[model samples]
Target: MNKTERLLAIVMELQRSKLQTADELAEVLGVSVRTIYRDMMALSEAGVPIIGETGLGYSLMEGYFLPPISFTVDEAVSLLLGTEFIEKRFDPTFRKSARSSRRKIEAILSRPIREETDRIQGSIRLLQKDEMVLMMREKVNLGIIREAMTEDKKLRFTYHKRVAEADGNRVTVRTVSPYGLAHDEQNGWLLLASCDLREDIRHFRVSRMSDLTVTEDTFQTPDNFDLQAYRPKDTRSTQVCAIFNPEIADKVEEANSYYMETAESKEDGYHVTFRVREPEELLSWILGWGADVVVTEPESFINRVREEIGKMKEHY
Candidate 1:
């Protein structure tokens, strides 16, 4: 590797341990003691807080970590997976940021580190499907919302919502914020905010938002705001039990991969269970599957499905 790359690797390796001897680092880098000393001097001159003694080798200063080398294997995997997912789903601005972040990470790794990263990349793969793509998009949107939440800023957007009285026309809304974003699997992306005018915790769908702008006006997130408590308590909050044909079990499994429950296989098919705070979302999903899936429980959910199907048939 080049000198800059080698120096970064040394700093990262040193940060991983308490104190490493010069000989150990030299051996790991395939270099001699004198070369190691020269490199150490170069790193120190470059403002790396490397501490050492005559007998001991070196250690990075506490609280001073190499940004690129600091991530654990799990963190690295999450970053890579999240970045790839965003690149596939988001608009140009977010896609560029994700690509840039990945490049910055790759530039900081040594040959060995790069190899380890490659292994992680090979171990996990996002099987691209329509639902997976949508999930990825939601993840990306959630990330943006989370960032805005952390900054405690207002977001301005033109929101589109269904207007049942007006032949399904979408109404536009301009909203501000009091807090961050929360993911409602049943509702897609939701921003928990006090509307600019209402000053109440209203949920706005991320997909319905356009021309989003994070404002400089900061607001305090209410300490009492709890997403779990705010959830709908009607039968809509009930758990859904479904069975999928074995032939399409894998696809079905991928669809609900983010849920808190597990899927088990039976002689007939695969049984999956999950909770939804809104039945409309689940109903839409089940209808999308046509006949490959069956809703096995929650009589209310079945009735809702029947009602929705009747509405659709009337329209046809």
Candidate 2:
């Protein structure tokens, strides 16, 4: 990366991490330790609110923010795609802000690049599936939950969960201390919270909530609660082995390798294994690939695939 990109990345790194050593930053950004020191000095000179400690490494001061800076075409496109995601799934209040932010980003770029970005943005479209569309229509007020989280207040709500089409569904009341929120392609918006009902941390699909109430009661976030570490670890998952066609190798690793455990070269192609949370979720992904991938898994997964196919045929 060039100096400008590296500088921006340095600022981003400091923002994401409360503290980082020069060695750690060099490893993450793929540069030498000396180069990291030089960049840190340059960023400090440029009035980035970077503070250093003798043994503790460097950090951005609390509440310090980088001013509007230039973005490369790829960076601009990335922001545009994220803004599109927000506009599509979030409430009208947030959607308006997303639109305005995109407009501001475009306004800052030069005309030629702006036109280029517009064309690239035009080629992008997000398909809101029926479930997500329904969620957006009956959307819970995320802003209220956000406020409650800010104030460390408890939230009470009835959550709806459906296990099977024929089995119907269940709604149960829950009081939770909101930790944070995350978005996924599968689950859309999810609220990560510590549930008093479950006596543990649970991920609640925000859209499936009803009769929502932010309580006057407040609680402190556990010092042990780390949102990044809260995600289910692969160590606790079942191992799934597969052979993937080489044609989609790059695409698969880039976009679909989150659950992957290990990948090895093979005579025919690449052999891989992923530690997955559930057979159903991983099976859906494998079936989406059709013949491009084949699963050689524990018989349990194979049986699930067979049963799902049987259901599909019976439905048809």
Candidate 3:
């Protein structure tokens, strides 16, 4: 059990009993006496009114109880939304715990509040397909990646890079010190880490990787490693324009860059303008759309695409 669950359990145990010794509490909770002592200290710090005597043991202060916590309408709705997202987005342990917690929250909510929350939930929805599927279908274990990140350990994986050529992708083995995970609007969950092969920071699409294994070796994050700084930035941003297939109009909005204004639709499809990232990155995205999309402005971007296509043809 995690610290949160243990703390809740401790409170419940105390509420039901008159007085409990540290040894008795430790035995019942399946934790060490030292842990119980630490928990008691923590509870006291949180103003739990846990009174202890030299010989008598521990008990709640007479007539004192753990106070009821309350949430405002917006706060409750926001929590429900988060719970729903976690239950849908995550798998296994995370999903299970979130489901249980959601149920607990629902049980405590007043009827009127619960009804409003239900209405809000019904109105909001996320998809497993479209953009989400690109990241959701991870051939690798997410838990393993999480463990590696948490332990600050090294990871070795066979990464499949999405190649432009008809010959398909090039697979390579990479061993890197795990730094953090980033979820890109276009790419899904990306592992941002120090790459030993490249001798620099690189982001790998977690869904595009396979044969992941955590190493016993530990690593220290660089002192200068700031995620915001690690991403390349240009003083002047590129104005990227593209047309999406009307069938996947939602995806146009999904791919909107941070600097992009709202996507506008013509009769054909959604017209997207992104004050986008570097030229190379934008080119890759346009190519990924294949025949379904086309770039309009920036004659320079059009020429680069033509050049890249020629190279791809040469490769084949």
Candidate 4:
């Protein structure tokens, strides 16, 4: 960091914490002790109210604070766009706060910067399905899940599975400790929680949740659990290979099936490999392709496809 930036950061660090030792400051700021000493001298010479004890540490005097930091046009634009995204993607509770924050940020910008920020922000569009327009049940579940996570409480809900059993039963009740929430383009909102019934961490799509309620019971989150880095293990190991007609190869790739591991185009056709929990998971997808795709490996899977085709022929 530049000297000016480092000076500002030192002031910020002091304001954030109490009695920061030179060693602690050096380690946190990634500078040497000698550099920290020099910086301390520089800060004191600049008339900053920093009190340093020989044995203890350094601290800013009570009631001392830095003035409001100014933002560049680019910074203002970035923050305004972030607030816009939050306003669209979050529930009503946070959407209102985002609007307020956007106004406050715009209010502080200078006339030229504000005009430039508005021009830039107007040119950029963050297009996505608004979360507020989602199903009422899903929106309610999202709010309850957020509150449960904030209060460190448990949540009880009925979840509808994506896949149904032979008996057509797809509903199950679950009580989970809401750990965190995530969103993706495909899935609107996913709740990562520790499931009581499954006795493990599980992801529940908010859209599939029904009758969600927060419980009064509170619990502490485990230190080892990191929401940002969490990914569910893919246990699908069965490899199924296929070849699609070159005419529809691009279309096949566009499908972007979760289990598609590899796709290669050769002289004859487009070779594709899929690893799935079970071969049956790809049965419908394969049938949808009709004669455009052919299975090339796992003789049993080919036979299963033949059997399905025979049944389909009989129906015809």
Candidate 5:
């Protein structure tokens, strides 16, 4: 590692432990006592909390924290996997942040930890197409939205939304407080905000927003504004069953925790059941699975699928 990397790593190691003697730090870092003193001075100059006494070595202050670190084997693997996923699956700005975070992590670890991160990164397979153009645009939009969210500022924008029919002209809306940003499988980016005129939780497509401006007028977020409540929940109380081919079963099982109890091994495939809140959401998921899954129950859902197929055929 370079000098800067070594210094950063030393600081991280020292921060993780209680007060250590200069001798201890020097021994761990494989450097002489004089070199340790030099490093300590450099750290202190860099605004690092390296307090020490004549006999006692040094310790980081309580409030002092490193950017973020992964020490455990599992944690290292998880970080690598999560970073890889973000880089592959998220829009451009998110991917850049993920890469930057990963670099910061690697700069602080020892050789062994670095090797572990490398191994995990190399072994993990994120099977998704890289949407570079979308990623880049989304990254810029996300940054602006995130800043506005943190500053608790009102936003002004010309938002376009379909009125009555899918082919209808877009309606322009002037909105206010943006509560949060959420991801929709079919919709891409959805901005959860309170419409100034309607005064309700309204979802707006981020891609459709134009002439966006962050206003100085700040607004209060609802105390009861729970993201969990806003998120799509299982609407169907009745159990709906489906059979998943082996290829898709493994992927589906890994993606959702609720399936653990419902998945059963069949002679040729895996049988699964779950409560679905929206048939549309479930249908989208089923379509993504292609021929790997078969819907077996809830005749209404099956009928809805047929109706959708008819509509699709009409379009074709």
Candidate 6:
């Protein structure tokens, strides 16, 4: 980091804690001990009110406060946009907090920065399309789920699945120990939890949940569970490859199908590979591109594509 940024970081670090040794500060800031000593000298010269004992760590003098920090246009806009997102996607409690936070941020900004941020935000839009109504409907459930997780309590809900069973039942009652919440641009909010029925970890879409309630039962979170590093394993094994016309290769890439594995450009076209649990999973997506794409792998999938095309021809 630049000297100016490092100085600001040092002030923030010291303000947050009671005592910080030069060695500890060096480790935290990823700088050499000598560099830290130099920074300390600079800070002292600048009259930062830092008190350093010979053996003890350095600390800010009690009751001393730093002035408001300056922010660039990009930094201000990023923080403001974050508050806007939380106000839109989160529950009422957090929505109120987000509004308050936005006002506080705006209150602290200089007039010129505030005007520029408003102009930039005016040109940008955050739209959730058809998911807005669903998210609003499930907003209450999000608060309940959060409370359950905070209190280490179990949760009960009726979940709707995307696919139905042989008996044509698409809904089931579930009790789960909530672990974390995840948001995907395409999938909306999902709850990662340990299901009592499945006896394993599962992801349940919040929008597809109903009659959600917190239970009296409680549980402890496993020590190894880390929400940031966790990724659900993909188990789909069936492989299929398709060649796409160069004219629409960029469009195919933009679609970003979950099963898409690889894309290679050849003389004929862009060859795309997909791994799916079933060929049917890829049928509609391949058909969406029409003449722009041609299936070339898995004779079985080729036959299925032909069958679908034949059925389409019958309509014409």
Q: By TM-score, how accurate is candidate 2?
A: 0.54
Candidate with the larger TM-score of 2 and 5 = 2
User: Tens-digit lDDT track for model 5 on 1-316?
Assistant: 6679768867776654557787876776678888888888999999997887777668887666665544776776687678876776555677777975665565455556667767867876756434664544454566677778889998888776533323454566576798988876656677888888666667777767777788898988989888757863333555677888877677988767332338888887888887643444466666677677778878888787778678877998
What would the TM-scores of all predictions be? 0.47, 0.54, 0.57, 0.66, 0.50, 0.70
TM-score for candidate 5, residues paired by index: 0.50
What ranges in model 6 sit over 4 Å off?
1-70, 136-138, 164-170, 307-316
> Arrange candidates by TM-score, highest first: which order?
6, 4, 3, 2, 5, 1
List the pairs of residues colliding in candidate 6.
none
Q: Candidate 2 regions off by >4 Å?
A: 1-90, 93-139, 158-173, 184-187, 208-211, 223-235, 247-251, 254-257
Expressed as tens digits, the lDDT of each residue in 156-201 for candidate 6 is: 9999876564467789999999999999887878899999988988
For candidate 5, the per-residue lDDT at 102 reads: 64
For residues 88-158, what per-residue lDDT tens digits would candidate 3 score against the true structure? Answer: 65545677778767755664555566577778778877665443553345423566787898898999998
Ranking by lDDT: 6, 4, 2, 3, 5, 1
Better of 4 and 5 by lDDT: 4
lDDT for model 5, please.
Answer: 0.70
The root-mean-square deviation over C-alpha atoms between each candidate and the true structure, in angstroms, is 10.8, 16.6, 10.4, 14.7, 10.6, 13.9
List candidate 1 segments past 4 Å from native: 1-98, 126-153, 161-174, 182-190, 196-199, 211-218, 223-281, 289-316
Greater-TM-score candidate between 3 and 6: 6
Query: Residue 114 of model 3: what lDDT?
Result: 57
Error of 3 at 60 (Å): 26
